[model samples]
Target chain A: MTVVMKMKDIFDCKLLMVDDEPELRKMVNEILRREGFVKIISASNCNEARQIFIHEKPDGVILDVSLPDGDGFSLLSEIRTTSAVPVLFLSARDEDENRLLGLGLGADDYITKPFLPRELTLRLRAVLSRAYFPVILKRTEKPIFRLGKTKIDLNSGAVITKNDQLMLTAKEFALLEKLYENRGNIVTGDSLCRAAWSDNLYGYENTLMVHIRRLREKIEPEPSTPRYLLTVRGLGYKLTGVEDR
Target chain B: MKNLMKILTRYVLSAAGVALILLVVNFAALITWTTQSGKTVRKNYDIAQIADSLLRSDGGYTLPETARNKIETNRQWAMLIDNNSGTVIWSLNQPSEVPQSYTVSDVAGFTRWYLNGYPVTVWKHPDGLFVLGNEKDSVWKYCVTEPMAIMDNAGVWIIIILILNSLVAVLLALLFGLRLFRSLKPLAKGIEDMAEKRPVELSTCGLLGDLAAGINDTSAQLKRQEAALSKRDNARTTWIAGISHDIRTPLSIVMGYSNQLEEDAELPQSKREQAGIIRRQSERIKTLVSDLSLASKLEYDMQPIRRSEIALAALLRQTAVDFLNSGLSDSYDLDVIIKEDAQNAMISGDEELLRRAVSNLIANCIQHNPNGCAIKVTLEKTLGNCSLTVSDNGVGFKQEMLDDLNHPKNSARLENHGLGLTIVRQIIKAHGGITKFYNLAEGGCTVVLSLP
Candidate 1:
């Protein structure tokens, strides 16, 4: 419940949406505001987008690839020169080349045109989470973490106490991260499986259990009687007594 | 053609004719000069006086001034044999080995053939036949010696003749080469124009007339092919553009309104579900549009790789993360295995294309194995190549799917199978890579992408 409150606060961020179609901008604007975005600015072309961007200084940007005066990619590049603010591209051209070019140009994400309303909102939230707090940084390698009497170094991918160091595989680390992301909250088993295996989450109940057992042995004071890593039975898994944001 | 060969033979015949004329002229000059020089040598012989002196025969015989002067002027040697006395007489410039005496038979044999291997003229004498021997330098020397000035003049004339002959030969060879090149120049120009993709027309004349005709025909055929191909390509491009510009905008409007209705709290639950269905169907349509457009572009090789240096390990990791965040699946197991060295392995490729190629493979696995599956993505660096292997633990692809993947045309009946595989093959090929599908023995499917 507290996590939901925190997410809603983050959702109330300001954003800039740029598109050539007036209907698209209006629709995206209404959707974003309804999703808790407070101050949303809209632009029909790159030139206007740039002006609004500089003046409003929105927290993030959702830019269309094609514009009247210039391209969204050029606008992103131009904005990147001055700031590292998050920029997501909305393009009708969904070719691999275009997507790669957009992301390679420093845009946070590339979404093809005619995207689902929920999908747009979710991507916006993801970009905002990453830009403000860098959730993705911790996914690969986070800072030092304290767990019970042990110290977990996310950067080194090593967990060490006074006497010994523990090794964690990439999958194990991701599983631990899902729990850490929702610290003191239950992350459903399905969510954990999806985070670990992506789309192949079914029939992985046994695999997830095995990884959880191994993770607990390294962090818990007793492998047989787990302490820090706990199961919520009908729910999923949770990690307690871990210092997480 | 036979006509061309006949015209070419004339060049060889004309050169040969010049050589024959020079040979005849040289032979005529040699005969005339030889006869004239032989008359002078006979007049200078002075045979009467030489015989008188030999007949004096006092063992102190002396040659007359005329005969002595002739010998001195001619640089000749003389010898006399006394056949009646059976003795050899005094000799001038005689070899030391010559005997002083001779028998009748010896005198007869020496005069008839030679005097000590020298050319000798015989005359009737009282005691012995008077014998005048030419010098032994040639064994059959000419009695009339050539003057020093005449020998030098002969050498100069021989060199001038050789120089003239060489100059004429060189001039003829150059003229032949120039004529050949001029006749073939149109053919060379036609070949160059064909290489440059330009319209070519060569005048079919001279030796290469047939070759010129062949080349012009080939050029015309190739131009026609190029025009037809570009026309088809432009039509396809316009169709794809239309799908993007015309269809997606209106689709976006329909999707936006439906989404708004779905989100309306006041709407009844069933009405909201209906709106949700509309949005879902619209999303499906959007996917189909993107797939069809990209597939067509790939089918005709319209897409080109835009290359950049990519750290492959990072890409693999990012791909796995994106799949997880895509929200497309909630019931699949995905795992990534990256070799230690592969973390820094880099290759030049189109990153977006590679990303899409890999994502498509993973998506295909999830789509096919609806119930559940375990997908493993392994990134490893081999000798000079990087391989990305995506394997799944589920019901592998059917025989028909594998066949279509390998040969797209064979499975034209299969709707999405051909399109997806075509895009995969095209993207990988554009990056200078290869893709393969294998049914693992463990009842799973595997796709290996190797890029240099």
Candidate 2:
């Protein structure tokens, strides 16, 4: 009950969904369609997801962390660079560092694998509410991509507190950047390793992961059950800010 | 074969020890026999010499019969033989018509026969006359220099002593054989204990303490190994527990999401998106669980590594290319270099596992590098062995950071909690190969896998 209160009212917006699994895509589409999300589209893979994005022009998007042709995080980044659609990373990479990297990349919030539908909805709404706040409310001067009081500068690759800038290693910075870029996609270990080091993380990928954990410690509000960076098991990490994945 | 060698070694040592003791006793007996026989021969020769000289004296030219008779009376029985002919020239207290034909030939035959086992001696003269005598009473001639009484007793005692000496030697040899065997019994017992995996308590032989110490040390080592195995079992249990807990948490979440989607009546699009998110998260959880479980299985699984003869060079090329394609990075900008000298390098390994391991390595390379980074994969074959090396020109790890790749050290860079390389190590170890990760000097990391 206490965790649920953390959810904030988000901007009421349209959303799109993409995945290879048709049943999954349809189920998600149906769920969102009933939640007053008018624009809900489903895609099987990267090709379909691209098509849907081009066609729908939705305010927010939900993309599977993994797709047939490519990963969802890259799609999220591609979308973010072009369109400021609030992207929530729905990924299977449930490791802590994976989620941290997704958030570091630019994702607002991260929801791990096997999350409750309600939890996902609540998280998405909170992220959207924070992302599309009215200008007057924004003037209250809270930093963007904040976890509690800590501020993450997604662009500058800097984490700012009340008075100091936290130190970050190269891998930490890369992990953060990857999360920030996706903003709302689950950045799986594979995706984060790819995004951070530009390859599939093999045997020593944990090295990059440790750095993310350290980064999380610096920027995360609680550092446990992280708000900005979240783990999605088996698939990847995700930054939570956009619609539910 | 080892058992056979051990038995053989035991037999050899025992036989050698027995043979050594027998050799020393036999040597001493031979020395004593030689010394005693030499003394007896010398004494016999001395007596025979004295008898011969007395017999050779010219008594044919004696002063008178009266003097000869007087000498014979004083000496008990003195007989003189002819110097040139086998005849008795003078006899004191002789019977009339006494056999004068008892000559040197008779004495010679009797002496040769007696020397075989009897203590009789033949006294020979250069003049051809001879005399044979027994110590009790001289049959032919008795020399004045010899005391007959003393000689008779000494001869009897000498025969008795020779028999006693031979008996004693045989008895001593039997006793020594028993002692030698008793000394060797401990060695045999030690070997038996070793076979049974029991402690070998060796009695201290003056010079054998070193060997005993070696046996004790071996037993200590075995105990240590047993202790280590128990510790390993404990660690394995802990690993299993950790895996179960980590996997269960995610599964519950996935189940919760499914239940929500089912119960909620007018699920809005936003709620549906959340469900989709929940479903994807579940999938991710399942994958991590499987990976962790796989790692645990690899640790304890005793099943032999499934091996197949595969063209390793081709596999490397294909795996690398597949990994490159799977990477999220833009491949057009990255420069990937692969070098292979082997046209057909055949290796025996689990194909699916090796491929997966290679894929993971390639994926790591792609993730670690920036856009347009150069990567190299090399496959080489030499002397019935093969090597595959993957190197990337990316942000190479610091010396200290690279040290923990395969090494089980807890480091900051080792936080992925992924069993990717752990699986790689297991797979390679199963194939009787080794995998090593190191940082490149120019810039990047290199992973080398070698098989024999």
Q: Scored by CA lDDT, what does every candidate get?
A: 0.75, 0.61
Which residue runs of candidate 2 sit more than 4 Å off their true CA positions? A1-245, B2-78, B82-134, B137-291, B302-352, B366-373, B379-386, B398-418
Question: Which interface RMSD values do the candidates have, in the order shown?
Answer: 8.7, 12.5
Give the range where candidate 2 chain B is weakest over 10 consecutive residues by summed lDDT: B133-142
| lDDT at B133, model 2 | 28
Model 1 residue B38 CA deviation in Å:
41
DockQ of each: 0.17, 0.07
- Runs off by more than 4 Å, candidate 1: A1-22, A35-89, A95-111, A118-245, B1-206, B254-276, B300-304, B308-346, B376-389, B410-414, B440-444
Tens digits of per-residue lDDT for model 1, A139-176? 77566778888888766768897899988899888888
Q: Model 2 over residues B1-452: C-alpha lDDT tens digits?
A: 35544554565556555555666687689999989987975653443444444432354533345444433443433344566665766544444434564556754654455322223543445544433323333333323566788787986876676556555655565565455445556666676777777877786664556666677677667767767985785576456645654554446445664656756677877787777676666765665565564565566553235578876654665564454335445542322333345545677787877887776776667656646466676777756677877778777765654566667553212246356666776677778888889877787788888888
Native-to-model Cα distance after best TM-score fit, residue B282 in candidate 1, in Å: 3.3
Candidate 1 chain B minimal-lDDT segment of 10 residues: B410-419
lDDT of 2 at A218: 87
The native-contact fractions of the candidates, in order shown, are: 0.37, 0.15
